[model samples]
Target: MSIKEKIMSDLKDAMKAKKTDELRVLRSLKAKILEKEISERKGGEASISDEQVIEVLMKAAKQRKESIDQFEQGGRDDLVDNEKQELAIIESYLPEMMDDDEIRSEVQKQIEQMGASSMADMGKVMGVMMSKLKGKAEGGDVSRIVKEELSK
Candidate 1:
């Protein structure tokens, strides 16, 4: 099944199981997906693909992580715990992220493949790297590794 279908199926399961937290997150995700679909339709585009669903999921996860960090920094343990739970729910659908070592290796491979040398080629290297790494890794981590590799 597609990501959106899987999410919808899981939403029903969560509802049946009386999983309040999971249900809340799933509902929010569905709403976001619908919003994106409507926006795309306005732009004269067709329905969204699984890749677009993943993009929405990633954005939601990023927002939750930021909320968690801010709550922790402000000494709001109560809010932090809530945000962490939501973040966990949001991440359940995401692919596993690459570790630093894995990301660095991939960056190095791209740099060689693209024949990119020095900081001047950073943008070209980054474009290829991000498209390849997409949902498997965070952009910040990929960019950092690319910059470090290019500097070498």
Candidate 2:
């Protein structure tokens, strides 16, 4: 099943199982997906694709992570715990992200493929790498690895 369909199915299951926290997260995700679909249609597009759904999920996950970070920095353990729970739920649907080693290796390969050397080519390397690693790796990690590799 598509990601959207899978989420919907899980939502129903969560509801049936009386998983209040999981149900709340699933409902919010469903609403976000529907909102994205409506916005796409209004833009003269047909509907949001699976890729778009992933994109939305990633954004939500990122937001939750940011909130967790800020909450922790502010010593708000209560809020941090809540954001962590939400982030865990959001991550249940995202594709497995590459670890640091994988990200570094991938960045090295891209740099070699592009024949990039020095910081001047950072833009060229980043543009292609971001598209190649989209949804699979975080942008910050990719950039850091690229910079480390190129500075060699």
Candidate 3:
């Protein structure tokens, strides 16, 4: 099944199981996907690609992570816990992220392939890496690794 279909199926299951937290997250995700579909509509039946669905999921996951961080910093343990639960639910649908070591190795390979020798080549390297990595890795992590490798 497509990611959107999987999410819809899981949403139904969550409802049947009386899983309030999961239901809430799934409902929110469905809304976001619908909104994306509407925005991309070109006059006929509106639909989104699986890649677009993943983009929406990634954005929602990032928002949850940011909320968790802010809530922890504010000493709001209850809110932090709630956000963490939501994050976990959202992440379950996302592709597995590359670990730091995997990301590091990929960055190194890209740097060498692009002949990126110093900080001056940082932008060129980042553009290539971000497109290559896309949803598999976060931008900040790739940037930091690229900077470290180029500075050496």
Best by lDDT: 3
Instruction: Evaluate candidate 2 by giving its C-alpha RMSD to the native, one decimal.
Output: 1.5
In model 1, which runs have C-alpha deviations exceeding 4 angstroms? 42-45
Tens-digit lDDT track for model 1 on 6-80?
999999999999999899999999999999999889657668898889899999999998898899899999999
| Per-residue accuracy of model 3 over 41-122 as CA lDDT, tens digit each | 9988889988889889999988998998899899999999999999999999989999889988998998889888989999
Clashes of each: 0, 0, 0
Per-residue CA lDDT of model 2 for 1-152, tens digit only, reads 88999999999999999999999999999999998888788557666788899999998998998999999999999999989999999998999999999988888888888889899999999999889888898888889988888899
Worst 10 residues of 2 by lDDT: 39-48
User: TM-scores, in order shown?
Assistant: 0.92, 0.93, 0.95
- CA lDDT, every prediction? 0.91, 0.90, 0.92
TM-score-based ranking: 3, 2, 1
Query: Over all chains combined, what TM-score does candidate 3 have?
Result: 0.95
Residue 141 displacement in candidate 1 (angstroms): 0.7
Q: What ranking emerges by lDDT with the best candidate at the front?
A: 3, 1, 2
In candidate 2, stretches whose alpha carbon ends up further than 4 angstroms from where it belongs are 42-45
Could you tell me which 10 consecutive residues in candidate 3 have the lowest summed lDDT?
132-141
